[model samples]
Target: MPRPSEARPSGARPSAQVRRFTPAERWVHRATAALMGVCLVTAGCLYLPPLAELVGRRRLVVTVHEWAGLALPVPVLLGLASRAFRADLRVLNRFGPHDGVWLRSALRRRGPRPAGKFNAGQKLWAAWLTGAVLVMLGTGLLMWFTRLAPLLWRTGATFVHDWLALALGVVLAGHIGKALGDPEARRGMRTGFVGRWWADSAHPLWRPGD
Candidate 1:
């Protein structure tokens, strides 16, 4: 019988898997997603007359929405304790020369996609979502505790809070659609490991050891 190493074809590369999301990172992602889902569902119930009538618990919905939105930052805050999560956050925050090219290509719908661990679009989406959530929380607090601000401030908060919530729904839908379209990317998130081949092709700039 041939030795295991000798059995491979000449010049063939071994199939390897790379770590993608750490357990800490995945847990944070899932926890945040669950809370956001609760917030969105409860917001729909509170805002949509049809849903409000069907649900028939206006006060309960309001309570749930408020609590869920308030808890949105908890997972991200906890995630900062993990070294891997912190490293990924740094990667997401920094935009290199290639990122501009990636954004332009993305907008033009031509040329090669980004080869970074997180693409430009993903970075922008993450940043936008973070800001939107913080703004929503601030506005929500103003609306919840009327004494926090004057009537004019409270009114403006309500307007911003409501419209921003609508915008979040749309952006989140697009995010989900993109995720659903990428099986390998989804697999990485689901299993925490991805093929080296995928890493090379989709994220050539990403090094597993990095």
Candidate 2:
């Protein structure tokens, strides 16, 4: 009788799964998403007068928004405890020569642009989101603490915070739209594994041994 491996169809491997995001990465992503949603919803309540009146509990809403914004970095900080997460951070921070080519091709709706764990667009989003969060948090703290700064500074912070929040909301919608449109991309975050073929075509540079 033939061995089990030999009995299988030619070119069919016993293990076809490709590891994508690690458990730590997935957990951070989910936690951040949940907290971000809370922040956005509460911000909406505070920003819109009609919504604020309907909610009728300004103090409670403000408290929730403040805490949610503060907690946004908790998951990422905790995930950094994992070596894999740290390694992936290093990968995300550095952009290669291919990234520019990928961006151009993506904009033109051209052929597949080989990318590693994260393509250029994803890296850009990550960087922008990080900076935005930090800005929001700093300005939020300024607005909340009241006496920490002069009235003029506090007013400026509030103005910046309000406009940035609006921009963040739009960017977040686009992010969700992109994720929803790509089932394979969503699966990587949802299950921490991606089909080998999907990985090969979407992120060829991230393949095994690459």
Best by TM-score: 1
Give one digit per residue, the lDDT tens place, for model 1 in 1-210: 532212333444445778999999999999999999999999999888999999987998889898999999999999999999999999999999888988898799778775589878889999999999999999999999999999999999999999999999999999998877677678788889876767776677888886
How well does candidate 2 match the true structure in TM-score terms?
0.90
lDDT of 2 by residue, 1-210 (tens): 532212334565536777888899999999999999999999999989999989978999989999999999999999989988898889889999889889989899876586988899999999999999999999999998998999999999999999999999999999998887777678889999866766666777885543
State model 2's lDDT: 0.86
- What lDDT score belongs to each candidate, Candidate 1 first? 0.87, 0.86
In model 2, which regions exceed 4 Å deviation? 1-15
